[model samples]
Target: MKNRIFILSILASLGFLSSCSDSYLQEDYSDPTLISYDESTIRTNQDLQKFIRGLYSRLGTSSFSGDYFTYQELTGDLGFVSARNSGYFINTNAENHLVVDGGASSGIWSSLYNTISNANLILSYEGKVPDNPNGGVTSKALFAHAKVIRAYNYLALLGLFSPNYGEGDQSLGVPYSTTYNIEAKLPRETVPKVVDNVIADLTSSLADFESDNASAIFTNNNSFNANAIKLLLARTYLYKKDYQKAIQFADQVIDLGGELVGGGTNTGNTTFSTIFTILGENNPEILFQIEYNNIIPSNNNLQAYWGTSGAYKQNFMAKAFWDDFPSTDVRKSNVAWYQNNATTYPDDPKPINVKKYLNGPRDVILLRKTEAFFIKAEAQYHINPATAFTTLKNWVTTHRDQAYSKSLTGTAVLDEILRQKGFEFFLEGMRFTDMKRNNKAIVKVQKANNVPLGEIPVGDRRFIWPIPLSEIQTNPNIKQAPNY
Candidate 1:
């Protein structure tokens, strides 16, 4: 696990646009002369595969794929109540705060389009792929990879700064672009349209003819299976809030030797915190993990930001945030480790600062097995409260089916699921995203010990992030989401 990684993480954090500082901002990527055909050789799979690898390279990037946000420090290290990472920290420094737009806002905006430009070429060329005389498909590997990557790239943009799931035509999203046309000026497509396109692309990718085994889940392991593609669909469906679809895709992975891990009922050590540790993924519970070689010159995630001691002191998680965890659960250590400053914590929330993730492998776990369970629980909660209560009870219990002494129903169950989700995904760059999706509020502790309100209710617009400003200057085709 420590050794595996994609060609490289091109999507996470590289301060791509942040470095430009407006002086040469427009010049950084303006010269098309760099990637034009006449300047280099790329006409076939042999030549084109290099470009495919490049797309993976970009997805692995520190800046775009967004590794910065996951690191606790950047998110907790801020001048305000929330926090700010070097990259665009949605917690603060967003349009709401109106300051220091860490090039991330536009960097992700640009990188996705950059990857799309490459994907367009592959898709166009994919149409002419000759039928393999020996087997079922000749271009299956690259074509499938391209379409999924392209669709995913768009979704990444959408997640960063678009409105809720169904907001279409009226709500702004990335401008739909398939070609690398310098003059291409496409406004943001509606949310519904983009998601439909993403589904179509991924579905098409799954259907592609694979003459070779190019589907690799683990990077160092270097093997691509249908499982990765399937889970991506599962993830996409979850975002769409299509519970049944999420269940469908998740089922595909489980059928392919994927199973949940936990001691039967009310009795296993498996919980939120342990699931994130390195040993956690070793279990079948890991559906998908962003493999990182962690080798210096190759690929490194936001290791620098979360670096325990080499850099600045660990950006400790807020004391109050960690206090909510039950004292008996081991997951507490996984969220935030306590420090000498623990005494400074506010009294109202009364949570102990945790020491979680201080010691774990650097590879990013994108999707885990427990999430499938949580998602299933979420879908079932409203639709089938009976099943939802059962699932919720089983999940929190020491053992899988052992009835919990305490339980919830209906919205109460939904609320519990969200609370655990927050504890589970804290600082994973998901708490904010999930909160927005559920329309949860931001309960800030203006005074250290004051109990403000139950939930600080956020707006629907808060769900999507603002399109970083840098992208608008160069790509007119890109449209800023509304209310930015």
Candidate 2:
């Protein structure tokens, strides 16, 4: 059972050459920019820094994190592709005839594996690279950083390709490789094993940071720090249904001076819209993001795909969904009606475009503090319903809707928490995963025609993406999702 692994070749031309086994070079590579490298290229602390930068570059690409959100949005129940524009993800939007060979699965799979392999290469230098005069970054710190990247990417792979955690001991999880062994053949680990591995890597990383205060070496939100790893651990536990652990980590983040962007008020200059407006700039709420600038602009089609004007406007919000938002809600400003132009379908009438990513060359936020509040609220619901109700009500009243006074109880408290989180994270790509983990049906409405696209029932095989056909053809060990 040999599974194909796409190992990245460091940019030798850029003073870094991260290479693996010679046999891997002979094989067909998924990314053209990926060339073979020599392990000796990474000798100094500077070289190690360059190598980590390379990993971030790969992860920041549209094919990986960018499309990650896009594909989920297309498949999720939130919105649909506009018929008035370019034919992007229309079939996905309609939930029609999804095949293993199609969708964003292949690119995402290759990109993530490439990142994991490169992270492994960095981890290989754990005890070798010495602290340099330039920065006090220790080899131990670099190794911990690699572990966080590898573990986080593995978690992302699981969310896309595998069933929800705790499904069963036999439920298949994606194949995970810890070492830089391109020739190694591995079978899928169980879902629980994969979750355990993610937790172990994060826990180990946390210990390394806590022992020597190594997290101080990396201060940017783009890099993984103690809080970022904590957030990821919180999310993993939340998915695994370990409520106590989830609340534990979530609280650690919240209590550590984590504040919302708008400060829970709409009267100030720093309102909810400031999160998107100050994309590349620092925001207190953002724990982790993929930074982009004029030198190296984001390739993510978020701005183009969701833009109200121009040829690339393919996706828009459902009017019914938009109408449901209270007029006083601060988050409702994220959508605006598309003014008719030569390119638009005039008959369509009042199509709304998502404003979150309209500004290009901005940072793609992956984790933030707002999610911590939601995680704690939901986790509390399972443990103490009364406490969860207060948390939910307070969060909504303070941050989102100033006029929100819903008297929710029991299951309704949990439902409102999810609904508010969905609205908070709209177009940021948390909706589909939220629906899947909670076993909620995907109820999509057509954006153009206002037609109900039919509900994808809970636990439908379609919810689980098929293993890419390339992997199937190349790796005898790989197992496709059932009924794919």
Candidate 3:
């Protein structure tokens, strides 16, 4: 008998733990039903293909549980609640990470772990693919894709739930799982250890992707491929403060022909608003994105959050972020603002809503070459500020506005890079991480509750998210984040 690896499925901490000996984990099927194999049906190419497709189906979309945009922007300085509602936005800005069973934490925790579980399931069946020279079945390709997705999901999880990774600090991070089994009782791993695990996964994934797939396959960035893995590596190393390695991996992506999304230096594509305007599979600038259409709309349509006709008009462009961009900058063109007559607070300026997620069938970018450019620029700044300045200038001039110019050195250069990053990625869900990494404060001057918004200073306890209550309740070994 094959050793059946029973799954201890924890659905977003839904607490449905199952075991191999437990009949409760097994379903009694009196008729024809789907046959699942923990180890037996690993021999067929069709089975492997089906398993891989299942994993992809579970991958989170731009909106919904795995919606990176909402989770980051709502908590950061760029977003604001124009009209208050007792929903996710309120909890997010209030720093309610301990309410693990609801809101962003619930969705993110469950969705990411679900993805991780599926990846682990595929990996459980490793070595089952035939190694035919004529390419009967490619196990390496399967493993690489699975590992890459797992690594990517874990990175996303850490970005939101864990504290900033410090070299000497031993703060806890989310549990690092390789098997979906009784090990669900495991306690949180240290941040450094989790980072190391993520790096190892990406490293193995890159080697596997390179060995199993053709270089030409990755030319299209939609799929998980070698270049995408390299981009992830770049981001991972950047977080670890390994600047040289970060630059090396980012350089690999650029060397693989990653370019900006526009048609040419200045006279190409649509107007300067092409990044937000253009959508679908043809957008050349996107390194990796989630495309949502009518056929496959399982994801949370972001339109509901920022659309003109959205249910709650709570989240809008904060005045601080809006004022940061000069009128000459092309990004300002994307902002659509209207006066709020409902409240007489804060001395009145029109609250702004971004046009990035105007409709449902839009594509959401998770990783793009533009991010790689920023990564490279930051890494360069750490090594050589002058060259970094030039790179930053060229990036803004080419894509943002022709007349934009800023000259600075030392700390100013770093500040400018992050500031520009904030504007460039406005409403794209990258601000909070940028703010944390740079040790910047979440300063807000506008009034929401009849008082000026107070600032969350750098290294505040609020920056660290609490381990979801459900996870703590279920797993006796778990500990809540400090100061929660």
Top candidate by lDDT: 2
- Tens-digit lDDT track of model 2 for 340-401: 23245442545556676656666778888888888999889989888998988887787767
TM-score for each of the candidates: 0.72, 0.87, 0.83
Over the stretch 152-238, how does candidate 3's per-residue lDDT look in tens digits?
888877776787778224567888888856346877888888889999999987887777762222223545767777888999998
Please list all clashing residue pairs in model 2, or write none if there are none. Answer: 19-37
Q: Residue 405 CA error for candidate 1 (Å)?
A: 3.2
lDDT (tens digit, per residue) of candidate 1 on 1-484: 1111211122112213222232322333333334334323345544444445455555555343334344222222211122222333333422243212543454555666766765675566665554345443245576777777788678776676776686444457667765545457677787778888888887876775233555531233222245666777776787788988987877676565534433322223234334445444454555444443333121223333332331222233544445545554445422322332434333333323333344324445555545655677776764787787777676667423233366566677777777766655555555555555566555542222222222324663444556666666666666665566
Q: The CA-based lDDT of model 1 is what?
A: 0.51
**Whole-model lDDT, model 3:** 0.64
Residue 385 accuracy (lDDT) in model 1: 78
Error of 1 at 189 (Å): 0.7
Of the two candidates 2 and 3, the one with more favorable TM-score, higher being better, is 2
Poorly placed runs, candidate 1 (over 4 Å): 1-40, 62-68, 71-104, 128-138, 167-169, 209-212, 216-224, 254-283, 294-301, 333-361, 398-404, 445-457, 475-479
> What's the distance in Å from true for residue 88, model 3?
4.5
Candidate 3 shows a clash count of 3
